[model samples]
Target: MSGPKEELGEQRDSTKKKKKKKKKTESGKKRREKQQEEEGVKGGGGGEEEEEEEGEKQQVEEEEVHSSDCIVLRGIFKLGKKSHDVLLTRTRLTWTPITPEMPTGEACVLQPGVMPLQDVFAVKVKRRRAAGQESGGPVLGVTLFCSRQRGRRLEEDTLHLHNASAEHTYTWYNTLKELVSGFSSRPKCLKVFINPSSHKKEAVHIYREHVAPLFKMADVSTDITVTEKKGHALSVMKECKLDEFDGVVCVGGDGSVAEVCHALVLRAQLDADSPEKPVKPVLPLGIIPAGSTNVVSCSVHGVRDPVTAALHIILGHQQQVDMCSFSSLGQLVCFGFSAMFGFGGQSLARAEKKRWMPSSQRREYALVKTLARLKPEYCHLSFIPVTKTTRDLFGHHSEDEDLDQDPGSVDAEGEGTWTTIKGLYLNISVMSIPCLSPHAPRGLAPNTSLANGSASLIAVGNTSRSEFIKHLKRYSSSSGQFSFSFVETHTVTAVRIRPRSQRSWSEEESEGEEGDSKTTPIIQTEGATFPWNIDGELVEIANEVLIRVHPRLITLYGEDMDEAESTVSCSCI
Candidate 1:
């Protein structure tokens, strides 16, 4: 769209044309004498150079008046084989065709174009001669701006600014380079981990094709490592020089990302000598979704596209996310953003055993198989709930008025005591960030947030198989899955789960349809290990475990939570 600058340009052109017509009406000798008198008054009897300089300054002021941002530079340049008037502002670069002075500058039929400075990552100047040669080709050169599109998705785009003086072109290039460099969030270098075995083993190809080119255009250096085996990323992270890179890039599924996150958290703790009170990671992380279920990437970037992820990294945009530390046997087990026990854990465990199959098919098989054998885990659970309280003569009246204010705020703390419940639960999920994905567009835990210093604790009590299935279906389309009668939801700072091990629990209550082999009654044995799914990785623990929520513990390259929009495609639920 045309801006005030265009209107002003047109008006300025019209005013000049009127002055020319008026001057033509006067005799040549009279015009020169009138100019000499005006120059004397305006320039204080100085030479023509003084008058010309004053006119240039006035023209610049006119251009400045039409823009809100500080005018950086202005010049005449060629774009698309046509000369145009170009204006650079602190926030954007704009250009318009320099049409002949007719009725007004608005008489120009072509529309103007603008490119936001934030999207421009790099700039380069073109020269006439070879780099090694003593001389160059033309006095004027074109400067190419390497930038990306701004929208739901980001794609690489370029613009060229041509000018008469190569020196001016170089100045434009340098000014743009300095501006792009001033964006402190944009990463200049990254340490990337690509899991070659993730999903159908396409992560390496995705990084090379979709991610590497963007990083190259942005001049973002990378120290890449193609993981050779499981836990390789974590192991390498421990040994690498952390100070050399600005951030870590994980190119795989949530499991691979989780492993790297866990490693970084642990490394930070080790370096700080504060294992008890761990600080946030030194470097932020970027996720490139190349797995079957890109849950973490989907939640952070709102899409599973690798190109979008690469753009976010190059731009250095970030979202401070909460991290969950799962502790068992009185020590840290691992760190993750979300976790699921009972039904979820069992399904993941089943899928882990079927690694020979494609990730999608294995997940589907595990889900179906687990659904058929859905049984509750009898356990003791305790949590410190977030509450809304106020000063009262007797007591507080309602929920915290700020409960709905900012989801990123720490859940009301120390206002209430720990609450405990002992029962048979089918599925329990703890989420710090909304686990957004194609299957759950609203997120698995919509009540929680990325940096809220709290987690959503959802406990699903035992119900008939069909009723549980109906509840699960809600996740495919909405966040009302917790609204079921048998489900209990809480916003809490911590959760402690102690499964009743060595207890034989009969599954007679779970079977709603008789005669089906999948619904047949089964008996449990002693000393059984409970399965846990922490960030898509399965773990087997027979003892009590504590899951604690730490606020803003790690930064991930992404947009803010409010702008995070996920697309729902899979109806697998």
Candidate 2:
């Protein structure tokens, strides 16, 4: 509406106003964005700080869970052949070095060697004056008994800890006492049976000298019984109150151990069938070797050491073992580790008759005499093979599998396929265990397992006398015992033996036949019973018998075999 110069100036003014409005709007948007960015940075920083605080709290909780509530004690601990300055905690004892260079809080950051409080057995305190200190002074001594493993060997070790004051020493002792007592308690009571007439007649002497002291030291009460005769232990086992004692200990040979086990099993079975209480709780058994051949003790303890067996009992370690039951025509004959016929039975019989002789000389004499009169007995041997799984084939038999079945009720005659063999055999030995002894270190059935629910049937077929003698002698050697062509072995669940002839030769006739070396001995028809050696004891029975294995029927105090492999083919040495 104005002139040209005025119009131009108006246009410039409007343009400048538009530019100012645009600039104001852009600056407002940038200010809002800057405010948002500052708030975001502040929020992120707060979140990071909160996260850092939470992480520190979590670490504190983790430390609380790992550490115990007890006051930490630092001292020098001397154990077995080694010594270390260790930190004693509530749940663990940690070995650490005492050095002036260790910083205050940094010392706990290092990972120290540790032993759990549960492994501690007991602690003894002795408050005496130091060697150079005055009498009744502040020096105190403490010894800790603990189960420890040094390399490949696991055993009980004594740790001696010294302190400056009686109060400090007492505090350590009480701490260990509270820890061990909370976890473990020693066996309070035991029923001990000693066979006075056992091999060497040293059972009583051994118990008095070596065993009784340990029991006293452990504060274990024992009810002692010395059997008068062969079956005396069986009678005692039948009448004893099993609930009153923690375990039963047999101090004798394999024969005596068998008797105690047999009585216990039979009683348990009888109790199981009773209406009042059907539960058959099998008590654990411990064995002390004091006999001519302590095969049971040797097999269980892995050595014929009574002290070791006692320690195992005191420590309360248990391993279950398979039991074998034998019956003749529905009549229970006996329970034993091994059953032998033919030459083996006859040798045992000869040994029994020569009991008046020296224990060492008697067995050697009987073995020689029986070898001279060695003759194979014609019989039918039948057995049912144990069912093997893929895992069993690979030597991985799992112990957790339920294998407990009553062998007496199991019908081996009608249930499964039985492999039958008719032959003249020099020896027929059925072993539940390896039958480990000094004479047969690897055991007669060396490849056998303790709780595998199986037995080993070893049959030596008819062979020449020289070959037979060689086979018998192989038991003394570590190898080649089962390598002979005449020797055959089978893993069996149950076995039945039947003699084709009811005739049995007498010992006198056997001696007479041995005198006449030029003539081959003929089978006699005057007798009807054959000598059966159940463990080391001899019994005359009809040659026919049924034997079956019960798995884990009884528990023995000992270390268990770690691997499932059979050791029969392996050398004992």
Candidate 3:
């Protein structure tokens, strides 16, 4: 509606207004960019408002990791110590300050340029393989460094970290990779619980004075607790925090070893969040023989050397073994070896009864006393097997019933109802090691492995007085050259024994029967109380006793002896 000149002036004025508005918008954008840059620079140490905002972000991230957390660690960390290996599986690393919030009391991930990490043990990492690359997976070695914090307790500070030495870092990387892909994890440190009352009442002193130094040499740290009484070791194991240790070792006989296995397995069953859910304890255990008959250790490691065993602990050598539990006289009892019932039973009892005597007196008395009891003039016995369904309760057999089924034939039992004679002797010999009799060529079960899920059963089934006397002489040869003519070896799931009354003379009756060579008739299969012997210990039981074998329940460490003696200079060194 305006003239041309007036319209041009109005349009120019409008363009000026638009330019002003554009300048203001550009200024606003510049201000926002500057503010954002400043915030990012000071985000870690800004004012309270900014700190609160940043803290919220970190919290959300940590909550995500904690939801699925699985790994934990706790141990001493000092400068310049040998680097120990920690094998991990299916876990991720999350940095946390050494505080209550951190399940594992590890100080922090060491950082480069913070502190001198020259002394801490080197780190080795390895990874398990993937489905396609099973053989050549991930492996890395790391040399962890520590951060510098003046006067700050490792437990209180958040830390920075860096890669370890080149070689160490590579090894650790590889190891960690392997572990995360595998089924088991081994920590860097272990807590050791040793039983001092196993074989003799001197296990504690023996381990401390002789074995502790060896473990130290192998760079293994241990917190030893000497058991005060029977089953004391098991109680400690049940109560201790097992996740903190890499493994556990026992320094006693098979009895002490059995206690540890039972405790671990039982606790695993009770734990709601157990890794091996609804299954047995996969925690590896070690043993050092301090017992008189260390069959378990001898069987697994082939030696009795404490030092060698300690080395194995540090090395983290592992193998799966089987364990068996049984009930005797309504009491649950676990044995690493077979339960002896016949002459083996009576002999064990005699040996224990004469224990208070002098060593020489004990041996002499046990031999003479058991010889007198071998006469068939006092007791009758029978053997019975537990049914398959009932045996499942306290058994370690595989799920396949065929593998656990008793392999012996039933046809032989009917022909030998009663072993009538003037003397009765039995041996419940079970062998896990190659050499059951030292200084002799005889072994209980030479073909079995330590982890095999079966046991060998050997018995002495002779009743002739003269033959008994002859067999007794063979034991004195130091070679255990027994007359094998009358012995029997049968593999069965279990055996039960019931004994009957035998004729006894009141000294005068014995005098009359001394010259009499007459044989006695067999008794009927009726109910009668009989004295049964278990591993040389005697206990009177109702006519039947049941026994079963456990193949491999634990790991043992001993001297590196061989099946055939080799002329290697044998020294504790």
Candidate 4:
């Protein structure tokens, strides 16, 4: 094919020929006739319509020929070195020239008709150096792109026509095909951020010794950044160049995962041009477990093994998982699991406070201390169930229950419900996995899916002290029995905790008395500090605390858990 420079030169020569023809037609007689005809049509509307039609045709041709970056397939005919062939469709423009040797940009006479789809044309390479210079360059390879029908001509003569059964065909090329061929390139590497300061420092070592090797095998490069302080991992993620790598991997527990999720959500929001824009700049996340609780990792991928998690990273599968955002005292926090207030809050707060002790020691201590001091406390809570209200009211919803609700439904009170939980432990969970109890095979909220729109809440009501002890025992024993049914999703708008003035209950109050209605009871809504649990971490709040669930407010990578094993709600999960 002629280069653009050569084609321009040919056009100049053609313009010169046109000028010569105009000079020859400069006679007064011919010019006068043309003027007379133009004057005759000047007053008519038909003449203007004809001109407009011609202009429209030219625009259509330009649009069709130059729609995308134009590429034309061409070939050499004279002194052909190889038997090159071309095939083209009716939708394609194709032709052959009569002269075998035309100067690069000079046009040759068309061969009177379009070339057959099976026709073959020989191509030659013409490498050109800079103007006023001469040098050899790389030779370009040219091949014919033909339909299967045309290519089949080489095998059998009967395959010439589109549906010909007996005819053979040959391939041909007429114009350069504009095709992009770089979309399938493999990811160069991954950027891994590990939080060593998390619950346990084993995460960094675990990822280095176990996870890195597998990613290397999969040809994913790695840039490891170990966090040193709280929110350090999230900071790195926010500052990192997201496009430099294929994906991001986090090694640590739920807190670390929460950090990553928050950063990602913020980044996503920043990258989007409008609030209404669907997710635009999402980067997939991989999780490696290295914390006191690897809830997010465990829920997404069935196993907690660091090596197994790393393998999932190597596989490079991505999923959109649900993350709940909570607003407490105007401060927003995104948690992979539920948040707690009241008794559940107190229990988790106590458990986390003991983390300074060794794991075995802490577990033993928590178990013994909780049992010895088993007691039931009560708090009036306002909850808005994310699921159906009727099912959530009586708690017929089991741990394995599946229900559907609006994806964006936040009721007038935000699906609110009110109840008084009796036990000392108050829990709110945005669970994504089954089997929260370490020792028991049973999951407190089995139906909770990773990307589900709603959260699973299993709160122990104000039951007897013995009952509370049994519920606590279930966490460390496989056979401990406790009812952990799914209830209407609950959000803690505000909780009022009142401790009983007298530590012990009065027998007279227990019996139905005439003054029972007037009696205020020992507990009053005053002078009490309530410890709260957010994803198993404890924080102390004043007498009243307010919380609300932000549905699908954050995003994470939800690993594939087979359909036979679990289900999701409203596609959020």
Candidate 5:
């Protein structure tokens, strides 16, 4: 046994060792905290895209939000064997490599990688799984998945943040979960309608292979309905408890998507118990183009790709869109985005009669056949115009076009003058969206915004057949087809077009048998019925239709982009 002096000396030396170790640990922690306080993370330098708020334009400057106030939690994390300083900010998750200062006075540079919070749809825990085990094992780190724009399309990228401490691993996971799940616009539950008879009849495969996996990765719950018949999607949507989902998604063509949209509008009216006053749908709609004609998807998203559409939905990209209410004979026909009368209606009508032929071939045949028998229709047109923007040539504006307030009443301020005309017209169109496609790259209504409080009423006056073909060919341009003297374009809020009786024809044509009527189709049926193409779906309504433009009545998943670079042209002509 040692003496009391020796024991006291050993105790003092052990106490000194403990103090030194504690001082070193606390100094390293304080150093990290000071670095975080002084040098906050840098952001990705890309310019922020504009966000459409309600119906107004607003810049979101998603990159300018990085500051001390924006930092949520940060620490040292590892990427492979190298260490990195990681930060979770209010708007971004950024990381930079950590390199110690050299003793030789050499300079070192740090480059950080960043991902905006809006683009990061999911964060999951990485675990090491034993053989034949799918559930639990030793904890690894965290994995974050981001959807970003690559060239003309959106692509998915991943980042693995390797950390060994299980407590910190869970702490980062919980923080990210609370932050990402707190986005009010991000859909947590979805009601999806899949049309089995889409373009190639591959809607199921597209969803399972391309769309559903992303939804699963994002932890979004879904209720999917596979449509069986022509109106199956509409019927199913009508009966569905819509409030149970965050949004509605339709995987189909423009026509099917249009039908789904109409169903949603009608459902809203039914729920509101007021069909007379058109009500906006509470849920935003997502369109996955799996069809031959994807006008709505192409026009809104600038591309007709399913993967891009799905990613937009996952990332919560949303914009308001205007809608049209077509009321004829004191009855609401349906709601749509676009409508066509006269020659445009005639082409679609002929195409409908030849459904046995393939879709492309049938359209070509209808175009050729309609051109063979092209004739002018006598009509009276009336419109209430909206004020023109700088981009528009002729715009008539109304002072009482508030989206939240009822658009039924007109205000005394800047009330538009009602314009009326009676003439022989070749074609007429009412469009709220630009109706962009590969054939019409600049859109059929190039000057129109997706949520502008007006619609474009394009009226083609009577012209020679060759001249009319030239006007039709102009759709494949970077502007609206308004070059001809016969083409009249007006930005209007309300339009009433009535087809006049053709006194030039005999009563035998009107009182003829069904076979004769079918063989010799009337150019414009007077008061009895008239063919109109509403969002690619053919609708026949008698007398006149009152088409009123409702601004920001529906929400869609997309952003505003420049007119698509059209590479395809119409060979049907």
Candidate 6:
């Protein structure tokens, strides 16, 4: 047996060992938990940092590839009167000095010059050799015809860039040619109508000589139809598959052009009226100006040059023009650029009677005869004014803007806005376009616009022969012709004309005294009808006629007339 002191010492030693082991186990568990928490935080943070770094690297690589993809060509170029180092890009041609003049301190540096590819019209390459050194070396030149703006005027300008070697020139030329060729949306195929009887009777010859070659060069395929009889082109247009062709070209005078335009408009309207199909828009019209008076062509092109009109068509340049519809008794008589009654109608009527004579001699004879028999006719005219708000808001707006607006909003019926005038009028002329021609350079209605949805009503009240002659002479002079007190002009959306006298013709009756017998004989009179000069054709219209303008009903191939150029009043006549 052991003593009491020994037993107490053993118990205390065992308790001390147990306490130390428990403390060690708790410390180990805490250390494991701390390590696990630290690892979780570091792993999540590391993954996000790696992803961010990878994204940054990818963005930098993409930027490098984009920069490398841009092809650059550098050369010296002369644009107009200035010379600069040119850098050609895919979308633009930039010019900068080879050695730029550095600005002092914080001053702004010279801006790099830029010309968008859209402005370029044509590009050509030419080779030249030094005098007496032709065999050894050739200098090559690249030329570009581009549309440029100077102040408010837009003009076509030429740029020439010279290179020492032919290889460089050819490379630049090919590049620019490819670029410019892409800018044109010209049609691949066209349906052409040629009126053989139009002025000079050279429409077919003009098409073969001047117009066809250009179309061939532009890679345009044409389906041509030479009209043999009146209304032949109109019949073809109405029956043809319009969707198969990209555009239609009319090679004729204003009459033929008008026929084609009317057919297209009528066809489109006819399609719209059908319940089975959607509306089809009219195809663009290109006029070659092969007529006696190409007023539409001259007005749109600012000149009656056939080649210019052809080039405009080939380049796919287009403009919108208003169309006038003349109707009598709810029947569309015709579509015209300009219309005339009274003296103008008389002149046309007289001219028609002398069609057996040569064109020149007939015109002269008709003018003399009409002037000798000049007399005012009593008539009533009513018109609705184009509201000032509509004119100001939509005058400069484009055809697309007009379409975007509610086209049906305009009320053609006079409603309460009709202004009536009853008087003896020497002449009444209504013009949609300016009606510019070789004879009338400033146009009969000089202030009118092609797509302004308005027409100019020029009324010449009763005046003396000498005074009217003076007014007519002004058309040939540099001074304008519309300043007379007897002349009145107004912009209108619609017009109605009615002659006061219905007794233009009468029947003779003879009564016998024996019984109630009577005999009535119809009298045939030469001047029994009122003639209307529509477009350039004359028609006998004895009753009321209503004329209205359809805004941008047709598209013409040309540039929009510049405000200054249009208003300048050309001296061609």
RMSD of 3: 22.7
What lDDT, from 0 to 1, does candidate 1 have?
A: 0.76
Off by over 4 Å in 3: 1-187, 198-200, 262-279, 329-331, 358-361, 376-425, 430-442, 469-483, 501-543, 555-573
By TM-score, the better pick of 3 and 6 is 6
The per-residue C-alpha lDDT of model 6 at residue 115 equals: 77
* Tens digits of lDDT, candidate 3, 412-526: 6342222212223344444433433232223345544455555444445555656665654543243333335544444334444434335322232235435321321111112
- State candidate 1's TM-score: 0.76
What does candidate 2's lDDT look like per residue over 1-573, in tens digits? 569989999988986896677677876766766887888842232454488699999999988967775546776754434455777877787775454545554543445677776555567785566588644654456777666654222366666776556777777777777766664434678999999888888999999987787777656799999998867877887788888988889999878888888877777867677522222246788888888777777677666667777777777778888888887777677777789888877877676666668987777777787878778777777777775321122232122122323334445347555666676778889998877766676777877877787888887878888888778768766767777777777788788888765355564455575643232211111233577778787767755788988777788887653222122321211
lDDT of 1 by residue, 226-337 (tens): 9987778878987899999899999999889999999899889888898887678989999999887777888788777898888888888899999988888777788999
Where model 4 places Cα greater than 4 Å from the true spot, the runs are 1-187, 198-200, 273-281, 342-344, 386-388, 391-440, 473-529, 543-573
lDDT of each: 0.76, 0.71, 0.46, 0.48, 0.79, 0.71
Q: Root-mean-square deviation of each candidate, in angstroms? A: 15.3, 16.7, 22.7, 19.6, 14.6, 18.7
Clashing residue pairs for model 5: 385-396, 386-396, 386-397, 387-396, 387-397
What is the overall TM-score of model 2 with all chains considered together? 0.72
Among these predictions, the greatest TM-score belongs to 5
Residue 113 deviation, candidate 5, in Å? 1.4
For candidate 6, the per-residue lDDT at 443 reads 76
Please give each candidate's TM-score. 0.76, 0.72, 0.50, 0.52, 0.78, 0.66
* Poorest lDDT segment (10 consecutive residues) of candidate 4: 151-160
Give lDDT: candidate 6, residue 80.
47
Question: Candidate 4 residues 61-135, lDDT tens each?
Answer: 898767532433333332233222333343343434344556797755544334332222112223335677666
Least accurate stretch of 10 residues (summed lDDT) in model 6? 505-514
Best by lDDT: 5
Model 5 collision count: 5
Q: What's the number of clashes in each of the models?
A: 3, 2, 69, 44, 5, 0
lDDT by residue (467-532, candidate 6, tens digit) is 888787676444458777677777888889988764441110012123212211111123336777
